[model samples]
Target: MADGTWRPYRVLLGSRLRSQTTYRRSFAMDLLGSLSVGALEFGEIYVIFTNVDVLGELDFAAAALLFALATICFSLADMVVGHADRLPTYLRQGTLDAFLLRPLPVLAQLITSDLSLRRLGRTAAGVAVLGVTLPHTGITWSVTTVVLLVLTIVAGTAIFAALFVCAAAIQFWLVEGAEFANAFTYGGSYAAQYPASIFALPVRVLFTFVVPAAFIAYLPTLALLDLPGPPGLPSWLGWCSPVMAVVMWAVALTGWRAGLRHYTGAGS
Candidate 1:
C-alpha cells in the first residue's frame, strides 16, 4: 500500500484487464454463466421453502437475505482470489518458480494474473437480490444496522478471500489435497446461503468455530433480521461477526506464511 507501489499495481491489474477484455465472446459467455449459476442456487432455496412456511425459524425472505449477503461477499472474494484456484497447477508446471523470481509480491502477482470479470456479473445479481428482499424482510432500518451490513460484507469478503489464500498455500505441501481445501472454500460458501439454525448443531459449530463460515453472512443476518435467537443461542452472536472475521483472517494469514516456509520449491 505504499505510494510507490500504486503505479506497479495499476500496471499489473490494467494489463490483465486489457487482455481479458480482448476475448469479447468468451467474456460474454462467462458473464452469463456466472450469473445463471447464482440464480439457480437461489432458485433451489425458493422451491424448497415454498412448500413450507419456514425452515426452522427463518422465513423465505430471511433465508434470501442470508443468500444475498453470502452471494455478494463470495462474488467479491472470487474476483480477487479466484486465481488462487490455479496455484496447484502452477506448482506442477514450474510456473510458480517464475513467480518467485519477480520483483513484486508473490501474492499480488498471483492475484493480478487473472481478474475474472465474470464475477462482477454475479455480484450484480446479488445486489439485485438484496435490493428486492431487504425492504420486505422487516429489518428496523437504522444507521447502526446499515453500518453493520456494510461491515459484515467487507469482513465477509476478507474471510472468504483468506480462505482462498489458505487453500492455495496448502498446495505447497499437498498437491493432491486441493479438493480437500475446496470442500471448505466452496462448501463453506454454499453452506452460508441458509440460516445457521437450519444446519445441525455440530455442523453449525464447525463452521462457526473452525472454518468461520457462519460469520460471513448467517450470524450477521440473524442480528439484522429482528428475530429471536434459536433455542439457547445467545443474541450477541450477531454482533460478533467482525471479530470472527479478524480472527479467521489472522489464522489464514498465519497458515499462508507457514505454508510458504515449508514450500519445497519447484520440482521438489
Candidate 2:
C-alpha cells in the first residue's frame, strides 16, 4: 500500500518484456508485420490526398503529424496495458483467481502481464515519421511548444488507456468480449490519425463528448500546428487534453472497482 512501492510493478513489467524478447524470431516477424501495416495505412491516406489538396484546412504534413501522434500514443497504450483488454477470457476461464491472489492492484497486474513488443515497431516508425513531418509542417517550435508536445503524447496515451480499462470493466457485466467497445479504442485511434474536423458532425461530437478523444488528438494538433479549428472551438482546448486524460482515468478506475465487486459477488 505504500506509495513508493513500485518495485513489484517493475518486476512484473520486466518479466513480460523478457518473455516477449525470448521468442526473438517471432518478435522480429511481428515487428516487421506491424511496420508493414502502419505503412499501408499511411499509403491509403496519401492516395486520398493526391486528389485533394486539403482536408479541412490540414495539409499533408499536418495530417502526417496527426497520424504520428495518434500512432505513438496508441502503440504505447497497447504495449503497456494490452492484457487488460483480455480480461473477459481470463475471467471466464477462472484465470482471475491468480490475479486475485496477488497483493498488487488488479489494474497494475493486468497492465504488466503482457508486453506487446510489436507495438514498439509501430512506435519507432511513428517517431520517425513525426520527426520527418514536423519540420515540414511549419510549426514554430519554442520551449513551450516542445513541452506541450510531450504533454500531448502522454495525455493521449492516458486517454486511450482509460478507454481500454473501461472496455475491460464492461466485460464483467457483458460476460464476453465486446467488439463494439473497440470503436472507442481502435476506432478512436484511427479517427485521431486524421484531422477530426474532416469527420462529420456526429462523429466529431462523439469524439468530443462521449470519448473526449478530440482533446487528445485534434485540439492539441490544432495548437501545435497553429491551424484554425471549426467554428466555436476555443484555442485553449488544446492544453486541456492532459487534464481530460486524468479525469477519464479516474472514471475508469471507479468502474473497474465496481466491476471487480460484481465479479466477486456473481462468482463468475
Candidate 3:
C-alpha cells in the first residue's frame, strides 16, 4: 500500500474518468440510458405488484425496498468489476498480454483501464427508490438499523464484485464464457430483486448457499423490516453478509490467481 503502488492506478483511473467526462452530451445520454435500464428493471417488480398485492411474503412497498438495496449494490459492484467481463475480448485482442507487460498487477490494470461512470445513474435510481419506499417499509430508525443498512450495502457490493471477478477468471479456460459469467453477475442481480421465498427450494438453495445472492438484498430487507425469513432463511442471517463477502473474495482471488497461472498468452 505504498503511494508508488497506487500511482499507476491513479493515473489510469484519472485518465479514464477524464475521458468519460470530456463529452458532456455523450455522458448525459449514457446516464439517461443507464437510468432507463434501471427503472425498467424495477418495473418488473412494479408490474407484478400491480396485478397482486404481494409477492411471496412481501407487499409492494417491501418489495421496492428489496429492489432498491439489490439494485444499488449490484450497480456499484458493476461499476467497479463489470469491465472484467471483457476478458474474452481482451484475450482475443492481446490487450491482456499488454497488461501483463505493465508494471502493475494484471487485475489492477484491468480495473483501472476503464471506470464506468454511467453506472452511477443506476445507483441514483436505486437511491430514489429507497428514498420513496424506505419510510413505508416500517423500518424503525435506530443506530443499529442505520449500521445494518450501511453494512448491507457495503457487503452486498463486495459480494457482487467478487462474483464478477470469479466469473471472469473462468474465461482463462473458456474464452467464450461471457454468457456463463453473465449467468451469475447480471442474472444474480435480476434474481436478487425479488423475495427468495418465491423461488422453488432448489433455486433458493442455489442462490442462497452457493451464490450468496440472497445476502445482497432479501435477507437484509427482512432484517431491516424485523420480519421473519421464510422456511430455511432466518432473519439473523442478514447480519452475515460481511462474512459472506469475505468468503466470496477468497474464492474469487484464488480462482483469479489460478487463472493467471493457466494463461499462456494470446498466442497460445
Using TM-score, give the best candidate's number. 3
Score every model by TM-score: 0.95, 0.94, 0.98
Tens-digit per-residue lDDT, 1-268, candidate 3: 6998878778888999999999999999999999999999988888888899989899999999999999999999999988898889988887788888878789888888788999999999999999999889988999999999999999999999999999989999999757988888888998899899999999999899898899999999999999999999999999999999999999999999999999887783
Off by over 4 Å in 2: 1-4, 265-268
Q: What order do candidates take by lDDT, descending?
A: 3, 1, 2
Number of clashing pairs per prediction, in order = 0, 0, 0
- TM-score, ranked from best to worst: 3, 1, 2
Per-residue lDDT of 51-125 in model 1, one digit per residue for the tens? 998886888888888889999999999999977989888887878888888898788888889888889888887
Give Cα-based local distance difference scores for all models. 0.84, 0.83, 0.92
Top-lDDT structure, candidate number: 3
Candidate 2's residue-wise lDDT over 1-268, tens digit each?
Answer: 5645988877777887899889889999999888877777778778988989888788888888888888888889888775677887788788887888889888888887887878888888788889999999999989878988999999999998998998888888887547767877888878778777877888888888678878777788899977779865665788899888989999899999999988863365
- True-structure lDDT of candidate 3: 0.92
- Give stretches of model 1 more than 4 Å off: none
Model 2 superposed RMSD (Cα):
1.9
